[model samples]
Target: MKKLKQIVNEVKDRIAEQTPPAQLTDLLWQLICYPPKMPLRLQQEQFLNQAETFSVTVHDEYFTKKDLQINGFKWGNGKRRVLITHGWGSKAADFTELIAALQENPNLEIITFDAPANGSSDGELSNFLLFVEAAKAIIQKTGAPHVVIGHSFGAMANVVALNDLHITPSLLVSLTPFILLKENFIKSMTTVGVPADAQEAFLQDFERKYSIPASYFNMPDLYKFDDKLNHWLAYDEHDMMLPYSYLKEFLEAHPTIRSRNYDNVGHERIIKSAQVINNVVEEVNKAIAN
Candidate 1:
């Protein structure tokens, strides 16, 4: 983490000192796309280490189209399937609590994979496109997931993937998801000290690489909740990483979507809540029962 901070500081200093606007913009674009390499946290490490003791089928695959090697783990033999993933810079083990809750259920078959540049996946950089492609690859391999749950960037990307892939998972759960890429880009720019004049250039370079216009990187455009699908959104009002306020208008407009609010837990911690685990289990059981 210290090294990551130093790298970010050095990038900011370079961005501040660069002579040409184009050069500064290019530097900022690289910073925005690069995820700082971080070792697993203590809990993440313990969870993963413990998971290895179980009878889990693990495989490493080089996704030919994406040019990256991805790792996947499959557990249980039930016919019902659930595909789960974590957010940017987060490993699949972030779902430890939920995984534990559902692991005992003999009726479930759980699938999890680390996205490129996250967890054990092999990549130096990743973006929304990479995330969507990873999800599509997993869905293709596992068949349509009856339930799909994702956190933060993972949640947002799943929305886009499910839509683009024409998949209608019976139950969809999104936790602390950003509504659009523009907000995410703005946050990155502010955090990295991209000068006002260089913002447009940075965005242009990004769009050129990703082929996604800023105007189209939005929640509404990426996902539309079908009436047949059960949609759930869990958010923490105090979440500093992703403000729950982003969903205010969207939630009001979508009356059918079930939402749960937590008071003390912040963005990442919400996943560890016992209440959250219970609620998700109950919801999945209901979906399964019906």
Candidate 2:
């Protein structure tokens, strides 16, 4: 935490040093698009070290059309497949517990990959579209899985990917998702002390680069692409990363969507919860059975 503060201070200093408006916008844009390379915590490191003991197969360089190579993992040989996607700055190994729990089902195949610029994947930068494309590539390669699971940003990415690819899974589990990308980006910029003018400039540049309107990054609008889609949404009221109001508004609008509100578990820890894992496995089992 101290190191992160130091880095943030350094960035703020650099921003303060820039005299030109264009330079400041460019710098902020670069910082926003690039995922920070965070060192693995002790538990994450230990998980990776003993990953082989979990009896999963590793694909060192799974190819995508954009020539990006993603590190992929597979468990079980069953015909019923499940794909799990991790959030930004998180790797597939982070899902070790969930993967292990799912392994209890002998008739299931689980697939997960490290998105480009994350984990063992090869890249220095990534964006929302890149995440969507990576998920599409994996689904295209493995075929549509029975159940699709995503956490945070990955949850939003999977929704976009499934709609674009015209591949619908039997079940989709979205864990603590950000409903609006533009809002999230602006919030991050404000947290890092980016000026409001610079934030606006970054948003304009982002839309120009992606060739999509900032409003199009909304999850509820994307969900409209397939209204019949079965969604299992899980969120915590006190998640520090995402305000509960955003989700509460979404649920109020779409009361038919299945959801579970957890207490106490914040953003990241929600994925690691044993209860959440069990619920996920049960949902997957039920989805596959049908």
* TM-scores for the candidates: 0.88, 0.87
Best by lDDT: 2
The prediction achieving the highest TM-score against the true structure is 1
Candidate 1 residue pairs that clash: none
lDDT tens digits, residue span 215-261, model 2: 78887787754457778999998988888888888877787779998
lDDT of each: 0.76, 0.79
Model 2 scores worst on lDDT over the 10 consecutive residues at 53-62
